[model samples]
Target: MLVYSFQGFSQERPLQQSKELPQRTDAPTNSQQPNNPNQDNNEKGRKTLEPRPISEYKIISVKNDTTHVDTALTIVKDYEFNYLRKDDLHLLPFTNVGQTYVTLSHTFNTTSLMPLFGARARHFNYYEVEDINYYHVPTPVTELYFRTVFEQGQNLEAFFTTNISPQVNIFIGYKGLRSLGKYQHILTSTGNFQVGFSVDTKNDRYHVKTHFTAQDLLNQENGGLSPQGVINYLGDDEEFDDRSALDVNFEDAENILDGRRFYLNQSYDIIKKNDSIQNNQITLGHVIDFTDKEYRYEQSSANEIFGEAFETTNLRDEVEFQEVNNQLSLTFSNAVLGRIGGLIGHADYNYGYQRVLIQESGTIPNRLIGDVFYTGATYNNTIGKLAIDGLAKINVSGDFDGNHIQGAISYPLSIGSISASVSTNSRRPNYNFLLYQSDYVEYNWFNDFDNVQTQRLAFDFKSKKYVDASLTFTTINNYTYFAANGIEVDQEGFENPVTFNIAKPTQYDEQVNYLKLKASKTFEYGVLGSSSDLIYQNVSSDDEVLNVPDIVVRSSLYYKDHWFDKALYLQTGFTAKYFTSYNGDGYDPILAEFYTQNQQEIEGFPIVDFFFNAKIKTARIYFKVENIPSLLFGNDNFVAPAQPFRDDVIRFGLQWNYFL
Candidate 1:
């Protein structure tokens, strides 16, 4: 498990290709990108970051290869299985979410405006997958583990305004929210997005305005897992494994699992105004928003154990869900007639919902599902001039929703510039899989297909100082896959009538493509600074998302400045990655027979990592030493621990601020 990465860090261009800075058009533009290395502002409103003082300073961002770039196409560990996996195994599972925003302003005498208060808190944590130890067969036990999740929310806002004479101003606000503490929200309420006003305008215009929003979150605690107790706890581990002559293929094998959650929301708005076009100013709006959801499921399993060595069944049953939405709008603007030009427009309406709760534990399991609520309409536009700008958007929802469109264009031509864009994207399906009900009961299969889609086409380019490029293509439809196995039979006349078990179902229709390149260069010779990246990936898994390695490549490098007089500031970096197989299609025969029961594909090696960053000023100190040339993985199934190959941290801090 030491798959590839000798050295070739070059891949960093992709923000929708915005035209790698030469000149090409698809129309839609505005330019302003760069600045924000650490956020700094001078003059009198002074602000700074990294020089310390943001509340005792302490911000550590770590992803250690972002879960191996989402599992570099299937397992590649062996520093003795990363020291024998287990510790919330996550070869790739994201979202350790975090959000913080606080604003307070009061200045009725400085500019004729005051009264604005804000508080926003968002927290997210998802850590599921407990007890999964598979040393590739042969009595390697470790099961019965599930129940690990957590989600949180809190929000409050207050508002006021003045300066009705400058163009026209008005404000009003009220928002309160709370969602207790739990892992996997089922329901939790608190809502608002209200704004009210009356207006009369200038600059050859007429206006009228109104707005509304309402949201709900109650009973949020849908922490799933009870499908017949996960199919009788994996059918008691296949009734105590130990089959004779080996020949297992119960449709890929998966005992039992479950999940469900619900939520609802509301909204409304109306507007009228006329300023016929020029730089651009037109408004005609009528919009509304609404949403609802509810889901549930139950399952069971059993069929062979001890006798022919383990056998069980239960896939899923118990489902319910709902959803709805509507909107209509038309807007055109000149960005308050700014330093040149800018314009925009919008229109909208859509609704959808579903319900399914096929249960059978304490009753209710007769299969009664429901669906019907697919509506559509949407449009957007933008225009700008000076540096340059152009943009457009279109959306059509219903019949599983999704009919997107995009356009962009930008040209700075001086202070070193370039931009480009092209788009057609759509990704939907996840209201908990259109209302859940999944099961496999250890080897007794069943399935219920839902509308699934992933359509994309993208191109981007940029050049402000250096260069950047990106390309993407995707196609996916009605994709749903599942596999499991476990079979055993026994009967010796008398009372033994018949009892054998196994399951099956593997869904598909997928295609993926990607190409990226990024570059950053700034060097006066010494104290140097350089950045580079290049990546390419391709995948076609009609076999269904598994060990997807279609192809991959990654790169990285960095150098820093200062040593003495400047007190001390140093930085260093190095990284490399590459993966291949798909079409040349390899691996994923049920995770290669659950790890080498056959079906090969795991021959790619070369791993490397190195890091160093130090600073001493305001007592700032940080030391890092990761995979300094170890490229681990020694087997034992792999899950982490090749001498911590990475994740070495040493930091100390100090910061002070003064303002009264």
Candidate 2:
């Protein structure tokens, strides 16, 4: 609801690694569980943990440290479901308009620290990823969420967590999503399961955290509507009244990605500890992790998508990735450090392997061995907190091409806070990029590419009451972009052609520079609320390569009130967003990438959604009507070059949580 400023952060930072647990006052002794099978009774009231301070809330996201606690002054993000789309395709909260691009953003990013086989487009990053969240509670807790919008799309989630003992906690969660997208022959199915446990000794000297994650993602690729068919819906051609009547490019194309991860972290205190809030103690920890991932693309009737011509047979490409890592760390802290304090040093060893299987080529395997060293320090007081981290990596037997250094610092001001970060990464191209072979014309490639180096600097400022802003500038050298320029002779300008061999950009002299600025503000009235966001972007290259809208604006107005004797609360709002016109990327299903396209410019259209959310006791429900204007009149709001945005949809969702 509001951005945070360090200057206005008044509360004292809670001591790090606090060893405190709330007592279960209501539950009778475990000795009574055998005699009282009346758990079905909400009957005899029991005691539960009192609402803890916001600073005690902890969420283990991939962005931050898993053990770090959350606080009120920490930044808060709007609900990701605001756009009526959750966890699907190149989208993030606060700013995203369903642009179809291979990369999540045309900006700088932190590459995955793990070994990757690079097959992301097919899954939309949802089914192939895992996010871990932790909540501390005295009694068993469970939350169920289900949502359905249109067609056969269904999003369902189940999470349960409980404390086995005062010092031990366990949790298991499942998330399944299946969306038969609005367009033809583009269906997605994903299944994700995770289980984890956290334990601590009675004296809090020894602790361990472990988890197992599995992800299975499947998608039916349609390769976007064919060129001829794409132009039919551009203007008022009256192609069809209903969206389902549209045509598709690929019918038998399918891509499947399977992944499994095992992780464990254990630590023991070697030095003594002080009873004070700040402490002098020594902690040594060990980390072990392993990951196995596989990506496969299958097309039975290649002729349907890409003609049987060009000596192309039924297409099937499979690749597997495996990685193992071991790490050890030592951390020490003292009271003299300030409100927040800590220092840690760590070393890591990693081994990776890859296997690729193309048309009748059998299995081709490759291996790599590497090591990395890291050191980090943090200091915080009532005035402000600062953290710094440095890392260096080298491959013992392979190459030290994947090496980088990153750092960030933040300070709070009187009315707002500001932070800056920088990262430089120089690494060898991914295995898939280096060597690829297939029977299809455009799907086969073998090239030696230069190393990729990308540097970025970012600065952000946030105000507690009014507005927040951030700016990012990225410069990429020797960028390896999946180009759409070159292809087979038969595939050039062919109407409804099935196969496309996009030329890959391997070497470049000029640096690709991209700059982005984002600002948001919220206005409050007596019973009405309004929030607005503005984004501006520019790129050094022509509009052909990185198609970015010059400006994007999103605004929302809402009213909140309680009725039925304050037992029912309601929030009704309408959100509208607009993006300036620009040429964007076009997706190629065969190669699983988005190549540059200078075809049609999609912009000037406004997307609006009417929503109503109500809270009754512990349960919350929301209803939304998305893209009502587009469904009523006016066309040409294509999310990608030829693919249109989702048609009008009536969506509703519910969240019910229980603690027993």
Tens digits of per-residue lDDT for model 2 on 423-449?
Answer: 887766665676565445555555567
Candidate 1 local lDDT, 247-284, one digit each (tens): 22121222111111121111122222344634554454
Q: Residue 527's C-alpha lDDT in candidate 1?
A: 55
Per-candidate clashes come to 98, 6
Per-model TM against the reference: 0.23, 0.79
Best by lDDT: 2
* Inter-residue clash pairs, candidate 2: 7-413, 26-47, 305-498, 306-498, 339-380, 340-380
Model 1: lDDT equals: 0.28
TM-score attained by model 2? 0.79
Query: Residue 390 CA error for candidate 2 (Å)?
Result: 5.1
- Candidate 2 local Cα displacement, residue 123, angstroms: 5.3
Q: Worst lDDT window (10 residues) for model 2?
A: 69-78
lDDT of 2: 0.59
